[model samples]
Target: MMHKPVVDENERRARQEAHLLVREFGAEAPLYAAMKAEKAIEQKDFGRCARWKRVLEILADEPPADLRRSAAAK
Candidate 1:
């Protein structure tokens, strides 16, 4: 019998928060996508990493106004 790994409650909550952010902030979606890509890389999940990388690239072409403002402020 194989047991499923238990997910930490905090990690689950964080994922839910990230999904909410994606739904609420269209422009900030890529930032979350990039973060997912980083996690995929850490897990050695190349396919998921590649998918998120593509999303990040596409979203990066036209950054959200908030991102632009933040970048300009830096």
Candidate 2:
């Protein structure tokens, strides 16, 4: 009989956290919004980029409690 290798607890937890991130932020609408904004920056759309940059700044500054918990759990 062949046996599958066991996953480490930390690795299992990481997978769970990754799933949550995807669930929370990987919806089509939100992903499209972020991508569109990022593309605007790439195209030298400074005005749009500045606006999107502020949005990103807000997201970056406010790390979710669940994310923090996951980091601390590691």
Write down the TM-score of every candidate.
0.49, 0.35
Among the numbered candidates, top TM-score falls to 1
Q: Please, what are the lDDT tens digits per residue for candidate 2 over residues 1-74?
A: 99999977645543444435444664332344367578987898876655555444434444545444554576
Deviation of model 1 at 64, angstroms: 5.0
Worst 10 residues of 2 by lDDT: 24-33
Model 1 misplacement above 4 A: 1-23, 63-74
- What candidate 2 gets wrong by more than 4 Å, as runs, is 1-34, 65-74
Candidate 1 local lDDT, 1-74, one digit each (tens): 99998977644444444444445666668778878889999999997787677656545654556444543454
Candidate whose lDDT is highest: 1
